[model samples]
Target: MVSARSVAVRARSGNVTRRLLTGLAAAALASATALTPSTAHATPPAHSAAVPAHALTGYWQNFNNGATVQKLKDVDDAYDIIAVAFADATGQPGAVTFSLDPAVGYASADDFKADIKAKQAAGKSVVVSVGGEKGTVSVNDEASAKNFADSINKLMDEYGFNGVDIDLENGLNSTYMAQALKAVHAAHSDVVVTMAPQTVDMQSPQNEYFKTALAIKDFLTVVNMQYYNSGSMNGCDGKVYAQGSVDFLTGLACIQLEGGLDPSQVGIGVPASSRAAGGGYVAPSVVNAALDCLTQGSNCGSFKPSKTYPGLRGAMTWSTNWDASNGNEFAGQVGSHVHALP
Candidate 1:
């Protein structure tokens, strides 16, 4: 699911610190490990208690990505869920670890943990995001599935993170990933879980990303599909629509809304500014309009939904740092709009 724009952006920036694990290596390593009971835990019924009725999600970059370098305390109040950019892959298959980038200026892990605690005290969820444009950690087999769950649960315990976000850009194994998530929940019952799949991932329910979303829909918090970096795609109506337009937002969102996902589980993910992504940089007004169109049937482009979904979850941005770099317009405007949704 890596987009051309994302590749170009990363290449031009030359920030290659993010690790890459190929599918073959991941598979081989996963097959070699022994499966444990913890990893084989069955998924319980879906239920999440942390997310707000209509929430605003923003990714806080752990590394310096030319966006504003922000500490956890600096994230905008409008954001109810602040996802830490990524958790790093370890030598062991499916194992991940996190370290604060010195570039972000955290004096110590304790300082960072305190910030996380403060955010939680304010009723905001701080989650660790796994996988980004360069993320390729795979959890295909049972052993790796257990490893993934144990590692993430360890991170949650160590960092006091509220949850985890699945942003695997290369590929996903829904069965094992679902197993891993259920195991994670088994360890932390009130955990908040979210996904940030690319556009094509949600175009059809048969897609692996969509299947994973459906497999864990009961407890899944939200699916904020990246609406940028994607070229033209088919809307729910089967019409091709280009990106950076309200039609693209509303039309594509319809597929998830109508395709058996609860309206509360569907959200629009976009860049905070033009610089945040290579393409699909819509104005905050368009984001608000898309929200309005989906929830109220007003402010719609040519592609209107057959019905309005007042319970439609909300919106998400690539990085809160980008929003801060851009005068916080996305959070100030779109965040306000999302909170006001009926």
Candidate 2:
């Protein structure tokens, strides 16, 4: 979804770049359907908090792009995990700020802090997400990595964020990113860390993004690979699955599952609405189909997983803003399906 601060990617035709689509601009279109699940316990946060029970994850944009403008407290409960998107990086090393959009409703620092706690009180995880389609933040070296860690930790304390999300789209340094995360986790053992890498960034274990995931696998919460924006890609079976198809979702997810990622650490990321992404936008039923196929091994496409992963964490959407605009179809349909999983 195109947030006031996030850049939107557009659909493009090509062999290489097409396979790398993350989140971009696009017109709204008909949605697609479903998927399955697996069960594996993730390391709980250090605090006495509720285990992550819900599966539907959504991003709460700090500003309104086209949809209704709302604050973090205004987000729907359908989202089990809510990530606050696009924390701006200050030119000074690892320093960062919320960079709330001036065009939308505004909230004071205290207002944001209170809302974050309120969301947590209701069992929702609120995390500060760094980077976006056009995010400039990066931990390129050791010093920058330290800066990243210190800055994020400061934000966590100030905003009551329980975790951090690595949505850096432009580039990633596996070593530095891992170091920064490890530093944060060292202080707050319960901190949740999520990543939103493009499809190409996850194809193999060697890719930097994939390496980063592996580097932090022990403490990582979920790696929700963006399956939209991408055009077509090969499934685990070596067959190509086109965008917006159940085969595409299951097939791509299989790559992560079989590529050394634990079932609990991998999640399917899609647009809340066609408008939220340039290309891939499937109906909630289609998403359910993909989830069922992967987790239950029923109603599957041509390519099914060799084994079921009942512990599979869940699904993620581009933004809660679009979900709200689309009548919350994504969270409504996918949320119910994920919660019903074992």
Candidate 3:
């Protein structure tokens, strides 16, 4: 089929990990405890910038399944894109207000349309995300995949969505994952198809294959490389996520130079929160640490961006809710990123 909008994906998912990873360093707001309220920050007046198609703008899982329709409305005011995650074995997404009704065999167009309108109202790109570390790759099987693509298209057309993000984690770590993406790309030629692969740790040499997400899709834009910055150093004792920055930055730079991707296509992710010397997993504290460092500048490998990849696209967060009550902290960071871009 002759298509002007479609870009053919030709690369295969390989085990070559030579590049730097990118992603959000924000917190996941799906906690059991009642979230703290965001300390108010003054808005710099609402102004819209003409964001380029290749711009580094995004919305962490700002809204997940079960997100009150009202809650979605609140954060929709800040971000340009919205990410919705899906995994085969995991229960239904519990954070966003919209979802795919297994029984209905379709996505909720009303919410999607509402999202597009909100993005337009705010002057940003609105897209959907599929998959995460725990995301489901099986759903992309041919038959089920066809249903997914069709449903997405129907919803997009019905609602006027701008694009989609393919965050198919796990099983997608292979070349077949790239193939599946090719199929999804064929399904929607014009939508922006983004993939969030782990960061390439050149220093480690143990994870070279993921340097590329099996080389698929037209625009391999925006990588969310959450540093494997785990361990006691990850404790929640009020400190910066300082241990892994050097490696993360070093790896990110490698990706643009060695991996053959434009700098603007990469979005560096830092922990927007902080942890102690022994925190087992990333939590709100880890995100807080990252946010605390925003004043130095947005250019470093830290959660804050002194600027979008001076060489790549821009920055992004891993989730929508965690470190923030709404999206004040993360959105400000995004605003800084968009304005700082060259």
Candidate 4:
């Protein structure tokens, strides 16, 4: 099967130009400094209540894609970390900005910021997501890395965002991306850092996404690998598992779990409903079963782990809008199950 990510890239316009620019910028950045693995920054005190042990993360789309448009305050209580999707790329490379999608019906940016504060007050983390399937922002060099970190920190201060979500699906440079995230953590000691890499990106520790995740594992919250839109892939046991199965979820997750990621830093990411993605939609029951298999070693399919990860982080969905569109079945069932994980 064709790679779902490659297919999405082909369907969109300007990707070629974006890739070219990213390559040029990366070359310029690399020449300026010899890139090396980044050192972990000391974690600072959290700005607000810490995320729940077993949490649900959902993307709140900045633009409507036929799914229910929602205000931040209107997001369901099931989500503990609400990622505002697709922070816009700026003229300056690696810098990103966010504006409320007028389609979402917010009267002003102030209203949106207030909603963010309200969510933080309610113990939910509101983070600005930096990329999407079509995201073009690239952090390939020291300068771009600094720009990325500064801009994200600025957004956090301006909008009361607790942290940032790295969803740069197009491409990533592990060295500089790691540098940028370390700088952000240095500035906001208690920031919540999350990542949403596609399935192939985390297939091995050598992959850029996996490398970046490991570089900052000390302070990383979770790496919620997208398990949908991907066809068959190898799990930790080197078994080829197709998407939309209990084995698929548990098996792929084993790569991260066994590849040096803390159990609390690995999560399962799935589409909330069938309409949410091109393919690989599983019922919420399946998601819950996968969680059970990982954390409790029960409800497992053909593949089972050598040990249980009781501290496993929990699950994430593509978008809250899709969940609402599907009658909140994902949230009601999977959400409850995630919170009940022990």
For model 4, residues 33-111, the per-residue Cα lDDT tens digits are: 2332132223332446788778899988777677888898888999999998868899999999988778999999999
The prediction achieving the highest lDDT against the true structure is 1
Q: List the residue pairs that clash in candidate 4.
A: 44-189
* Global CA lDDT computed for model 1: 0.82
**How close is every model to the real structure, measured as TM-score?**
0.89, 0.86, 0.56, 0.88
Show model 4 residue runs off by greater than 4 Å: 1-47
Candidate 2 residue lDDT tens string, 138-227: 687877877787788777766778878888777888887787776776545567788888888888899999999898776678888888
Clashes of 1: 3
In model 3, what lDDT does residue 30 have? 19
Q: How accurate is candidate 3 locally (lDDT)?
A: 0.38
Q: Which window of ten consecutive residues has the lowest lDDT sum in model 3?
A: 1-10
Residues 81-120 of candidate 1: C-alpha lDDT, one tens digit per residue: 8999779888888888898889999989999999988888
For residues 181-274, write the lDDT of model 3, one tens digit per residue: 3333333333455555444222222343344332531334455444443321221222333334542343343444344455544454543333
* Candidate 2 weakest lDDT stretch, 10 residues: 28-37
Candidate 4 vs. true structure, TM-score: 0.88
lDDT agreement with native, every candidate: 0.82, 0.73, 0.38, 0.80
